[model samples]
Target: EGIENTNYFVQTSKKKVILTIFENRVKKSAIPKFMEILIFCSKNRIKCPKPLADSKGKFINEIENKKYGIFSFLDGKSKNNWNKRDCFLVGKTLANLHNKNLRRSFKLVNNLGILSLKVLYNKLKHKINGLIPNASKPISDEIKFLTKEWPRCLPKGLIHADLFPDNVLFNEDSISGILDFYFSCHEILAYDLAITLNAWSFFDGQFKKEFFNEIFKGYETKRKLNKLEKDKINLLLRGASMRFLLTRLYDMVYVSENELLEKKNPIEFYKILKFHQNLENINDYIK
Candidate 1:
């Protein structure tokens, strides 16, 4: 009875349970890898929905030619109206998660840029050819730029990688839980921050200064940014926007029937890109 990705809610006399059934189409390698990451995040005090273990203490089960897993239901609601505090908390949480010393225990997940961008580009390039008018050249140019720039921006770490509002649960005024660890991976901390900032700072293609300040303030509380990191943020934000826009446009044209996945408007990121283009310095909002 859940809305997204073959999920079910089971109510028993003792407890309520959530069953997430993974798609069989996904690579066999992805199952254990995803489970390991989720388990690690939960153990690390990341506020993720707790994975329930079976009698054997295994967190996942195989059934019906698909994978199923149970998680404790987090109690909270998604807020439409966001403030500085919320932004700050989210930013701080992300920083803490990225900064944790996983050491050599966690296997680094690769192909993030490829999976999030390059693969999708290869699939959509022929279909979107000439259909979007002037969209092609800029999109192509951005892909080229990001391909080179992403690696140079930062190194890999444990990142939520997808921290949109819908993926978070808040109780009263603070974060109660984080959900959807499917996109969790080893990636650039700044890249993760960029994704979060793009989602948290701006609204409907417009920059919200207070919200931006709140998030940055919150993040800096846990992890201070160096001058180089600060200098790169605006451009990184533009890259994040383009990454999202590309994914959204591809999904809109190719996978619109995925009713469970919330479709994002590409134009919103485009607006953010244009807004930054007009700014002379990234610190304009920080102060």
Candidate 2:
């Protein structure tokens, strides 16, 4: 279901859970912090998986020289086609996560932040261009512009950072689970919103303003964006697109095709980035 970690569903007479094997550049040192995040989310009443400890009271352990963890499997499934209510629910849930006092608990550095994006783009630049001829220059130009203009100091907190639809599972109308916190880190709260907006506000390669408005409305119910955050939304959206674009590009260029994982097309975010770049009035988009 995911490109990063190898996951298997294990069902027993007592319960069903997920067994995740760390893979595809997942750092061994960061596993504990990821478990800590799940604990924090559970404490805050955010529906997410809680890591299960073994007889030795360890949440993470080794198998075949690789770190692994078992998580309480969530009850619902992710939807491919989201309705308006789905958009609103996801937005509200994300805001609920952001509003929690997370930094006081712990801090996890974002491995895929702007600088990391630049680094990854540099690594994959030539390969990506090979895949899409004459693509390198425009991507490099976008990366430079984003690095120079990246926003700072709007609001900082723990963010899921990767809340694409497949990462979220629904039990009918409400979000039953928010999965894949591997990219979860402390970052600008509004940047997280921007990432989510870019992920959930599109349908069949087209941006839907109605869906965007509903998500914004739902998010405002819990946490209102400051003027600065509002002003930076478009830029953050572009940055978010760049982040995914590069990461997906890296995976596409390097990682081998696996039956268990479905590789996302980087061109999806490329189109998204172009859309934000061509916007005439940002104010009209958000409000």
Candidate 3:
């Protein structure tokens, strides 16, 4: 089956293997980077699909104008809808991932957290200025607030910055495997949690109390957040929401003409920011 550019499937033979093929769009330099991260995760005892080496003992193989690799096929099903238990388990897994001691370290060239929004704003700011008065001001204010608040709240570490539902696999009530380390990097662990919370707890841009509680509860079980971290959660949530909203908005406006990638609704995340604005205080959830 195809999910975006990556193709995944199980082998039919007696020796079953999970195959992942990436198109030419995946850069050659990034192949080794991806392998290193996966190997590090495996060595650190993280539950991910184990990479299978070829005859020469290479974990990755380039073939047929694409990058091909095999992993141990994990037996599980992806949930179409998420529940509190699922969200909690996923949250716990993400926390554990951030805590892993990796053998090798990687440096990020672009701040993926801010990249989407920066790109979107630069592309549309001129047009949006005339079309939607005061649109630019709110975005600028939010960016300035995040820039000042994010660094003060927490330092950086190994983080699974993108924890979307599709990246997690659930077997029964537990998280069996965590896949797709493409967006993984060294960043604030709280930001990772914030990203997960933004995706897991928010539905069409609104916070679902049950879901948020479950995710927060699960994360707290692994590692408790300090007062500063707790306060930063709301700010990070806003930043993360803006990141997705701006990217979706740009894609909706500029790239929607493209037939390949489906456009996401930018309005959903816009609603999420409004919901956060209505919160009387971030401390209410910490208790």
Global fold similarity of model 2 (TM-score): 0.94
CA displacement after TM-score superposition, residue 202 of candidate 2 (Å): 1.2
Name the top lDDT candidate: 2
Off by over 4 Å in 1: 1-4, 24-28, 101-105, 114-119, 126-133, 151-155, 256-260
Candidate 2 wrongly placed segments (more than 4 Å): 1-3, 103-105, 258-261, 280-282
Using all chains and alpha carbons, the TM-scores for the candidates as numbered come to 0.86, 0.94, 0.84
Locate the minimum summed-lDDT window of 10 residues in model 3. Answer: 101-110
Mind giving the per-residue lDDT tens digits that candidate 3 earns over 145-182?
66665554385677776677877887888888887776
Tell me model 2's lDDT, rounded to 2 decimals: 0.86
Worst 10 residues of 1 by lDDT: 101-110
lDDT of each: 0.71, 0.86, 0.71
**lDDT (10s digit) by residue, model 2, range 1-287:** 45468889999899999998987577898888989889878887988988998899999999889999998889899998999999999889999998885445458888889888778877987798777668888999988888898887778988989898988998888889988888888889988999999999989999999888888889999999988888888889999999988888877877776534567888899899989998734476865
Model 3 CA deviation exceeding 4 Å by range: 1-4, 23-27, 102-104, 126-137, 253-262
Better of 1 and 3 by TM-score: 1
In the range 159-277, model 1's lDDT, one tens digit per residue, is: 77678887778899989887666666666667778889888887755678888888788888888877777777776777777777776777667664644565666667656766765
Give candidates' CA RMSD values in order. 2.9, 1.7, 3.2
| Model 2 steric clash total | 0
